[model samples]
Target: MNSRRDLLKTVGAGMLLKLIPVGAFAADLVKFVDVRLWPADEYTRVTLEHAGAIKYKHFLIENPWRMVIDLLDMRLDTTLKDLTSRLQADDPFVQQIRVAQYDANTVRLVFDLKTEVKPEIFTIEPIAEYKNRFVVDFYPKYPNDPLLALLQKEDPMLREDEISRALRLAEAETNGTLKLESGSAGSAPNTEVAKTEPNAPVNSKPKFEVRRMITVAIDPGHGGEDPGAIGKGGTYEKNVVLAISKRLKTEIDKMPGMRAMLTRNGDFFVPLNTRVKKARSVNADLFVSVHADAFIRPTAGGSSVYVLSERGATSTAAKWIANKENASDLIGGVNIKGTDAQLAKVLLDLSTTAQINDSLKLGDAVLGNLGKVNRLHKPRVEQAGFAVLRAPDIPSILIETAFISNPAEEKQLTNAAHQQKLAEAIAKGIANYFAKNPPVARTPLT
Candidate 1:
């Protein structure tokens, strides 16, 4: 009894329903830019413009070197050749340029060294007072300069996978497996601090077990403008970690005797020092940083936990985590060239021994807890000097939840239920640590 038009409309709607796939609308194609190297002293001048191609102001700094190219939401579409040609033809100090696509969202333009130099990479986001702009880092690379050496050593570029390797090396040292040390390592400026250890005995428990509300700091590494590790499918390390961190926080909050605070609340940048400061601000009982591992090869898998190591990364994973953590400074706004090299090195040296010891204990507890929920890389802990875990007094552990670079594991990491399991495991670890070795009561919670 239906009219011809109504019958055709009903059939068309049914056909459309059959053609559509579930969640088909949720996917977006990933876009990326290419990168290549260029010669310096090529571009005498560089300029940036707004969305409509309106010219914006720009400037360049010769010493403590960098280039500031300001723009208003300008989509940078120039090829690497264009960049190289500009630099080779005009720029004075730049010997050559090396460009790499850090991710879909960022590009790294390395200015090769013609002389001893320092550089900083930073950016200002669109705010009420200012507009979004990109800053170029080009500095002289000093050879064997002590302060530069220290910074370079801590610099993610120098020590890749430092955290994972350092932890494994630390474990190896404890196990008497490997006694690896670099030639210049012992000669480092703060030799005394490196040699000193906490007076607390390995077996000694806290003197007084006073019940208190223990606050734990959880730092989910890399966010916003900085994505820690990129996977094959374009799943961002920042997004994955924030998910895990939130899950961990939820689990921690449900626990009766403890509380957890995150280094960051949303998709924004948080510095390594600021993350440590957040733990101190909360008077944290412990600090545990969560991260996903990435590697040059996709074969890397398994979970690893790390503590601080002054020497270098003890294992492969430790090295990767340290490298990843150190890059945050470049993205976060600290000009390595501007920092007092001696002071930074000294602070790092002083914190190494104590942080290493505390990191071991913390690592053991977390590793033990993770074992109950999922498979571990090994039964022992690893060591590495991850900048984020460099809090002087607070015991800090950096846990590589899993290697997101590995395809199979990336699937597991992206799963919500798996993330819940991982979070639950970490929370249980924190709870168990407190139960066994209760922290001495400090100030009351705010």
Candidate 2:
């Protein structure tokens, strides 16, 4: 009798489970909310956003060059398949993408590559409005040199000469035949070389002044997954700041003996330290980060310039702005495990007093010129601990073009004519600073 009772209980539990709706089980499966692909010359990033945690494994395959990623315990869905449609014909890295259900609970993604690539795949926890994200970045096996790219863009005709000179200087320095000396803490380093002739004098003064192209690193803040501050009219801070930065670059490039290099020339996110590294790599004369400000209060309107402050932010507003800007990396999704610890330490520890002073001078010049185009947020430049401005050697400043939160300023920021005017004012300010300070000889990158 007991054996019969046990059998009846087992049958009853089985029946109960069968009666449950299939839709109830399906709802528990992870659902991909959205997918985004950002392609640029530097790298390509793929983001998969889902409502719940996901386990993934990715590997690289050769002989045709493909990347395979397996999503464990996730069902294949239409949103996951949409990744193939996002690939652009002119994408620098990827040629095609294929998605399939490899098993009952695993969705596989295969990325066909145009060339050899180094891939970094990771996951990010939910933040702000973003859900759990699985991110993949494809970088070239051999990355292009930022300095070479800058020179080529400035003048292709002069690229060969510049490269040859840089190579020769590098060789001489390595052989202990050349030494570079700076007149002061903030001045450019002067190149001093030993005589080329055998048994010649050990020290020889430069015969003439060496004037190289002046490089200014123009950074357009907030991009890709990070939309920055959104205005009431739906203007994205990333888009407007990019337009303004590009215009500023055009204006700067037109100046005599001056050239500009944009940290990013497209819609992509760059880590803050990467921006500083690019400026230092190019031996930039000045680092200008362009941004559109936002405030909780719509009444806040006007332009402001900011330099790095060691003590603390000059005001509460400055501190708030810095905190917001600094959060960009978190929103943009940096692979924390892949970050270079040494590089980060250098960026954080190397802010010098001299750099700050020079930054202040540049800020003052830019602030004065900005007042001509729009109302000044403050009569003087504000100071804060901006991560992008922590290049130990280069003078850096952040410019808040206008408060994008304000309706009037948002409309003006979207206007092309106004953008051009802002560009002109900024260019004039840079010109003024250069005229008064006179950049010294450039130091060659090692």
| Predicted structure with the largest TM-score when compared to the true one | 2
Model 1 lDDT tens row, 171-287: 444344433233252333222213342463433332321223567888998764467788897887888889999999889878876667777656655567767766765567788
Q: What C-alpha lDDT values do all the predictions have?
A: 0.61, 0.86
Query: What CA root-mean-square deviation does each model show from the true structure?
Result: 21.3, 5.6
RMSD of 1: 21.3
Runs of candidate 1 exceeding 4 Å displacement: 1-211, 332-346, 349-352, 441-446
Minimum summed lDDT over a 10-residue window in model 1 is located at: 41-50
Write down the TM-score of every candidate: 0.54, 0.88
lDDT of 2: 0.86
Q: Over the full model, what C-alpha lDDT does candidate 1 score relative to the true structure?
A: 0.61
Error of 2 at 64 (Å): 0.5
